[model samples]
Structure formats: structure tokens, C-alpha cells
Target: MPSVTIHTTQNVSIDCETARIGTRIGAWLIDAVVLLVAYLVVLYTAEQFGSGFNREVALRLGPIFWAVLYFFVSEWLGSGRTVGKRLLHLRVIRLDGEELTPADHLTRALFLLPDVLFTAGTLALLFITTGGRSQRLGDIVARTVVIQDDPAADLSLADVLTIRNREQHRARYPAVQRLAEADMLTVQECLLRYRRYRNAAHREAVQLAGARLAGLLGIDPEEAAADAEQFLETLLLDYIVLTR
Candidate 1:
């Protein structure tokens, strides 16, 4: 139940569950197995071309070289995913939920030596459990965190306008085409607020939304304000029907 609340640039705070240490270690193990397979293939292919002792050394060193290159390029170009992270539904992202650039990926991958390799991830485990935001040394240095990507629920404009007088509402405000998609979404949220709470804030939101939408569609603001909740519902229905 450990979570980190991230404050985005747009001033929205989102609470996200931190990826558990076990999950992260599992992902790393999966990637390591894949890399091991790839390394064996490379060594077997090279062994066919060289002599005994020299071939033995090439088999040892060549895969390490390829693994380093592979990790760097995959992490960078794959946008902070290796095959394992993708399968585990884990992604590396900035603290603000923004996408990481190649430089950010490179920085984290390069710090793997101290954070993961020499210490068998002892340092990473210490940092993540104690660093407050589930950060490993690489994540701390790169301003990133590994998050489990949970799917969000979807809502449609039509879905928000469900009411008894939907047909009548649609008929009353046929000019809903004047509202853009974003405006329609705002209206949908306002209608939901009005329906759920009917508090001062919710009522005020509906009133404001109804007035603005009425203005956009060339309706009288006085009429819109008088019956703001009904007006907003009608506008939402009109938008849903007209847009479809």
C-alpha cells in the first residue's frame, strides 16, 4: 500500500503505487535470461571462426561487449523498456509522469554498475525502500521512477448525459456542435459534479458551464442561469446526440 503522489507540471497530483522490489527483481531476472540466451548465440556463432585458446577468450569477452551495447540501445530506443519491463507492465518515467528521453535512459543504464552489478542490487534495494519515492540510485540520478501502468476507466460524452429527459434535452439545444471536444468533456465533468453533490461548488460549476455553453450556442444567459443544472444537462445531451 506504499504510494507516491506525483505533482505534475499542470498542477495535478496523481497517487501511484510504487513497483515492489520483488516485481522489479523479477523483471531484471527475465531480462537477464533473455540476454543470456542472446549471449550464447553470439558466442556459438563466433566460436566457429577462431582457434582454441583465442576462441575461448572471444567467447568470454564478446558477449559482455554485446550485452552492454544491447542494454544501452534497448533502454534508450525502447523508451525505458527492455523486453522484461514491457511484459511486467512496468515503465520508467519522470517524477511528473512525463516520458523519458534517450539521455535519461542512458543515465540510468550507465549507473547500473554501482546500483546493480557490483552489489547484486543491494544498493538499489536500499535506495528504493528508503529513498521515499521508490527510487534506486539510477532513478534518483536520472529523476525517474518505475511505475506499474494501470489502465484508466473510459467515459464517453453520451454516457455522461444519461437522464430521463435526454430526448427533450437534445431537442432544446441542437447547437451543441459549437462546443469543441475539450469543452464537451468539461461539461460532462460539470454535469457529473452537479449530479453527485449538488453542493455550492458543484452548482456553481454547472451554472458557469451552462452559461458559457449557452453563450457559445447563442442562447440567452438569463434563461441558462435560471435553470443551470437542467441547462447543462440539455447541453450535454445535445453535444452527445449532435456529435454522434
Candidate 2:
């Protein structure tokens, strides 16, 4: 699988696997089936009502309007996931590691006309295959790519909740309150990297980060140096306990 590395503002690097072409096509087909069913249901309901205006609107502007609205609203509210994407464990993410904005959602939605609807997915497949990041025309225009979601790759709030029974655990570091959520995320990423590779470079990174955090929190350097990994682990638990 092809992957892209995104660097957060805190300089934490995250590698995300791009969705396979077959997977993308499968997701698109699922979405298309859903939209087709929805469109037919609405058209049938409008016809049964026997309102000329409703019927006219359904005939003239139903499919396009509904599709655009569906894509926009689903991605916006679901955090860059449509029904198909959610089902397939796929998510759209920005290259710059920032949250998607309204403009990004709207741009992708509008560009779907040329990328999928008008071109019948031909152009989309071309771009996705050759773009080196599995981005279609809409994704390129919106500065986004579809990535396979890997739950274990990230430290989610759910994972934090499972860390040593939050209610019963006492925080060891009171100064953890001084760090922002992003800093904690960086710490978590550093820990994850070290755990994944278990190489000297990653171990060194964890040690350096632990020392830096200890200095920032006014802990003695010798204490952090004693067992930098344990020190960082305690800080992670402390941040979760104190903040949440």
C-alpha cells in the first residue's frame, strides 16, 4: 500500500496508508447505490403526493442537488466520512495535517461533477493511479486524499480512557496541566514510534522528548534521566488523569 507522511504543527510525523483503487471503487459503488435508492424513494413520494411543483422539482433538480448536499453534509458532520467511507473505514485527510474546513468540503463536493459524475470516473481513476498519493481531481483540488483508517496507529480518546481507570488513578505530575493537547499528542506519537521500531534512533527521540518535557514542567533532569521512558509514560497518564 502506498503511504504519505503528514507532519503536524508539533513536528510529529504520521504515516497514513492510501486507500487501494479497488477499495475506492467499492466505496463509490456503495455510495452510488445508496444515492440511487434515495433518489428513487423521493421521486416516488413526490409522484404519490400529486403535487405538480414537487414532481417538477424532483424531475429537474433532484439527483444533482441531493448528491451535492449529501456529500457536503456527510463529510462535514462526519469529519470527512461519507456513508460509504464510514462503512469501508476510509477517511479524507488534508496533506498538511489540519482539520478539513468548510471550503475544503465544498470544493470537493463541487468538483465531483467533473471527477466522477461527468467523466464517469475515468478521469478520477487516471489521476488516482498516477498522482502518487491516490488523489482524484476533486481531492487534488481540495488538497485532500483518501486514507485507510488504522485504529491502532493512533492514540484516541477511547485509548486514553482505558489507561489505568481514570477515576481511581492519581496524577503524578501536576505540571502536566501546562501542556496543550497537541503537546500530549506529540508525546503519544513519540512513544508510539519508539514502540513500533524499538531502534536506537527512536529510543533517543523518546529520551530527548522526555528530558525536554521534564525541563518544561520543572522536574529535575536527573529524575527524568533515570528512566526516561517511564518518566514519559507517567506524564502521559498524568495528563489524562489531571485534564480529563
Best by TM-score: 2
Alpha-carbon TM-score of each model against the true structure: 0.58, 0.67
- As a TM-score, model 2 comes out at 0.67
Error of 1 at 197 (Å): 21
State the TM-score for model 1.
Answer: 0.58
Q: Return the number of clashes found in candidate 1.
A: 0
lDDT of 2 by residue, 96-186 (tens): 7777898999999988888888888899999999999999989998889898875554443223434444566678889998999889878
Give every collision pair in model 1: none
Candidate 1 Cα outliers beyond 4 Å, as residue runs: 49-64, 151-244
Q: What is the lDDT of residue 46 in candidate 1?
A: 58
Regions of candidate 2 where Cα sits further than 4 Å from its true position: 54-57, 152-244
